[model samples]
Target: MNIRPSAAIRQNYNEIADMCRKTGEPVFLTKNGEGDLVVMDIGTYNRREKMLKLREELLAVEEDRMRGSKGYSVEEVTAMMRNAIREAEGHGTAE
Candidate 1:
């Protein structure tokens, strides 16, 4: 983990942002000897957020399956989503 004191952020904001952009990794900012915050470029932050959301969804699905809930396979989910889109667009179901 790339770590820097919070004062470094106040003093070298541009350099720190540049490092985050170039490295595509978060910079850990510490305050008073404790972990404070993380800084990352916008693109990296968006991608990380999307990945985390997908992981959460996967975990939910796994838990549901473990509880004996009927789960759609990827292909079934894709087909259902496509059909829904078609219906929303006023196109009749292709099935």
Candidate 2:
């Protein structure tokens, strides 16, 4: 919900950069009263991108489920997770 004129990027770059870093949000820039660009810190931008990609993957999984894709039961998933944890911890295999 942060909005600023495009010129503010040039005139007050440091302030805008600080706001983005502190808030982890994007600043909307308007050119001639119209939406022009968005500015955000690199870490926030990367995290947002990662979230979007995760959402897309979840959506795809949902679509596959809707199409009758195979899925593991809760017990099977739990056992798989246990095995993975055991392997990661170098404790040999889960029984």
Candidate 3:
């Protein structure tokens, strides 16, 4: 949800923004003119705007998992991961 305010709104932007955040609303601001120009509380606005992106990424990852995306089983994955750690720790090839 976004809101647009005239330039006058800037006089009390912080006050209005606090209210908006509390109410889960948004305020769009503009110069001393009509219609909206500047988006308000844009940090939250951007993050909320990316919600679909995040959800889509998660969904795609889940779909990949469902399609057997991994080349190794759990045990194999864990061992491979542990082996990598060991190799990194200067403990090459415990075998």
Candidate 4:
């Protein structure tokens, strides 16, 4: 984790922004010995948001499965995904 005093951010905003873009990670800013804010490039922030949403979806699916919900086998899921892709690509059918 890259952490720095809030004053450092105030003094070197451009440098910190460049670091976040290059590293794809947030820089933690602290004020009065406590975390104040996070700074990150937009693309990194979007990717992190996507990853967190995906994790939440997977957790929900796992919870449903644990509740004895029926689920597709790996091959069934793969074929369904392939069929969806084929339709999306204008191929009309997985067959």
Candidate 5:
């Protein structure tokens, strides 16, 4: 993990920012020998948020399945995807 003293932010802001951008990872900043803050580039932060959202959605779906909610079959899902692709391509209407 990338780690830096809190003072590094004030002393080497540009270098830290460059490292975050280059590595696509957060830099852990510590204050008084304890974790203080995390620094990451905007793109990495956004991607992380998207991934977390996706995981949450998947978990909800799994919970629904566990509770006996209806699930789509493989063929049904395939057809739905094809229909969506066609609609996106302006060749079909929403069902």
Candidate 6:
């Protein structure tokens, strides 16, 4: 998602420094004999990096279940549900 450009990032030098402190994101700047480009903290740069990790995890789980991953018995699943409900109700333990 594109963040809106600040007036300083658009207007002044000190603005980039001030805004970087607040947003943890960089702004754009132009150098002498150069053109417009973004400026930002390395931390923000690293965090903005993306990967397919989430998709890979979901696909792995689906493949395992389809290929006969061990199944739990109904009694075991029912006990787990009862335990979760008891926890949600703020009780100390489930019977």
Q: Is candidate 1 or candidate 6 better by lDDT?
A: 1
| Candidate 6 lDDT score at position 79 | 89
- TM-score for each predicted model, relative to the true structure: 0.79, 0.78, 0.42, 0.74, 0.80, 0.32
lDDT of 5 at 94: 46
Q: Per-residue lDDT tens digits of candidate 1, residues 14-76?
A: 999999999999999999999999999999999999999999999998999999999788999
In model 2, how large is the Cα lDDT of residue 83? 98
Question: How large is the C-alpha RMSD of every model relative to the true structure?
Answer: 2.4, 2.3, 4.9, 2.6, 2.4, 7.8
Of the candidates shown, which would achieve the greatest lDDT relative to the real structure? 2
lDDT for predicted candidate 1 compared with the true structure: 0.95
Which parts of model 4 have CA positions greater than 4 angstroms off? 74-95
**lDDT per prediction?**
0.95, 0.98, 0.71, 0.95, 0.97, 0.67
In angstroms, how far off is 52's CA in candidate 4? 0.7
lDDT of 5 by residue, 1-95 (tens): 99999999999999999999999999999999999999999999999999999999999999999999999999899889989998999998546
Runs off by more than 4 Å, candidate 1: 73-82
Query: What would you estimate as the lDDT of candidate 6?
Result: 0.67
Q: For candidate 3, write residues 21-81 as lDDT tens digits.
A: 6766666665555556644466667778799789999999899999999657898878888
- Best candidate according to TM-score: 5
- Can you write out model 4's per-residue Cα lDDT over 1-95, one digit (the tens) per residue? 99999998879999999999999999999999999999999999899899999999999999999999999999999999999999999999787
* lDDT: the better of candidates 4 and 6: 4
Clashes (N, CA, C under 3 Å) per candidate: 0, 0, 2, 0, 0, 2
Output the lDDT of residue 55, model 2: 100
Query: How many residue-pair clashes does candidate 6 contain?
Result: 2
Candidate 3 deviation (Cα RMSD): 4.9
- Weakest ten-residue segment in model 6 by summed lDDT: 1-10
Return whichever of 5 and 6 wins on TM-score.
5
TM-score of 4: 0.74
The candidate 1 region of ten consecutive residues with least summed lDDT is: 86-95
